[model samples]
Target: MLQMNDKKLYNDWAAKTSDSVMKRRPEINTKWEYEDGVVLQGMELVFNKTGDKKYLEYMMKSMDLFVDENGNIPKYSSNEFNIDHINNGKVLLALYEHTEDERYKKAADLLRSQLTNHPRTSEGAFWHKEIYPYQIWLDGLYMGSVFYARYIKEFGEEAEFEDVMKQFTLSYKHTRDEETGLLHHAWDEKREQPWCDKETGLSKHYWARSIGWYVMAIVDVLDYIPESYEGRDVLLNMLEETVEAMMNYQDKETGVWYQIVNQQERKGNYLESSGSAMMLYAIAKGVRKNYLSQDWFEKAEHIYKGIIDEFILTTKDGLVNVNKICQVAGLGGKDKRDGSFAYYISEPIVTNDHKGVGPFILASAEMEMLYEERK
Candidate 1:
């Protein structure tokens, strides 16, 4: 249990942890990538909730490193048409809204341009990457769709929003397992990948973080969708359905989800941090937005506590750490990812990966808002 003083500090944990993430990187030395977007997204939430300029400043400084005077990202290449590249557009859009800077606008436009030509499956889901052709990964939903929806809401035609909805609905159609009610990590439409089931084109296991990415994408994208839009309910229904499936697999004793979500009885399976954090974040935001019932929030409260007890760590020097984050996972690359149960567990588990910390902070922000409302 958190100490009494620490309990009071829960309200500020988002900002504090976000700051910790900022201090660790503190520069634009890294490539413009999804990991940075994840952390910046958490910072964006904290800035929204707390009205803190420092948080905003940190965001600006970090982004300014890559987005220059002419709005060029030195390291980015649009020809790649990678869906993960779109993730950073969320921050670019947020930065533009706050500052009304043309550079940010131009940078955002460049990312949006990618979607116009990004390679896709015959059914129109964005391929996870240029290299992984004909593949749609659950991770890509959050990477690409959230930014797509937000971009359309900000600057694109109303009709363009249809493309945003297709990413979710189509991916769900392809990757969803009817028997388990869980989504597989990736779907290869041609079933050409060695990892994919030849007939189904689906990966073998239900990876928790991939589903976490999908769920968080659904809830976050719903923010930009108008209530009058028909697709809004489609997304809401998906959120409810996915959350229900997630809850069924959550370890009753630990209140955290396993890395291979549906395989709790498997010996090597363990509760993972990023996936667990992402799940709690989705549930909290879904409930706060009234897209889900309050009963879900009550259930999420237990899961949130479990996240703290299980993944969050404290140092003697007082820095907070997020442990047990899977360093990286993917399918069908030079690494030859097979996407089996063993492959999922074989990924390195490490501390303070942005994937885990970012969602943990985002989840904290939502929980804090709900707590304040009750008080």
Candidate 2:
């Protein structure tokens, strides 16, 4: 029952976002970073939908800040071997394909080279970063795997599929709580990190955004993985199980999710925006691709409305903003994030963070498409 104005929601927000981001690109970050990729990637989708050259221009202009004409990323260091750094490669890949710019390809090549020596666990999962040794984080899967799959599709060998599959399978196997089917934020393979359980090697709590990142990774990576690939079914099964588990924990009243996913009754834990948007995008995309049943559409519709009502806002300037986003969360950093319920809920909830805005736009795009097709 979407009104005509409802159909324009996605485009309006996208247009406002593109302009807002462009105005602030200089201050967004100093180095080549992942948050830029998150927002630009959403803008890429908007570009695809509307054929707006300005969206593409904004993406290229933002990236040019880091990528020199010689194709070197000025501030990026491969030696860091940080999986988070690889997230931007998705946008680079898009730029290379669309504009056939060699600089973009060479920049992407630089990121690809990092995985050549990126630290991995004994079972072959990429460590979250060189600093966090022997650890696999759910967030790393999205940062690394999506670009890895896309790179393999464009310029890699058939043998690379094994490496890609291991990232998803190994991360899921190690961190997933079998009973609940929800993954903890991270796992310390050596069980040495203070944040992890000494015996189980798993973190203490189920963080909604971490699980959200994991599910979003699965659906996005599936794009470049061929249907006939042997591991595709495994990824699909994992997606279904994780999404179903997420549904079981969704706030029935708000139709969103809590910061500490399973501890809904816990005091101070509130509904979160970024994670909810991530879930909406994954479920709606799954149904659109026919990987999920048609019956799931109603649920996707519900989530879309819920995200709109619970988190969206309008500025006095007539632009949109996403609020109530957990600014950041992680396990076992210098501050020793213990992955407890308090740790997840204590992060500053901010407005219009890229983590929330990008996913909200992506979700809106999916809902827009679904509405278009139904008409």
Highest-scoring model, lDDT: 1
Candidate 1 lDDT tens digits, 1-375? 222343743646787788777667778346877888888889888999889888899889989989989998888999988889899999999999999999999999999889899999998889999999999999999998999889998887888889999999999999888877899999999999999999999999899999999999999999888788888988998888888988889999878999999889999998999999899899988888888998776687788878888888767765779999998889989989888788889989999988888898889998888777755
Residue pairs with colliding backbones in model 1 are: none
lDDT of 1: 0.88
TM-score of each: 0.97, 0.96
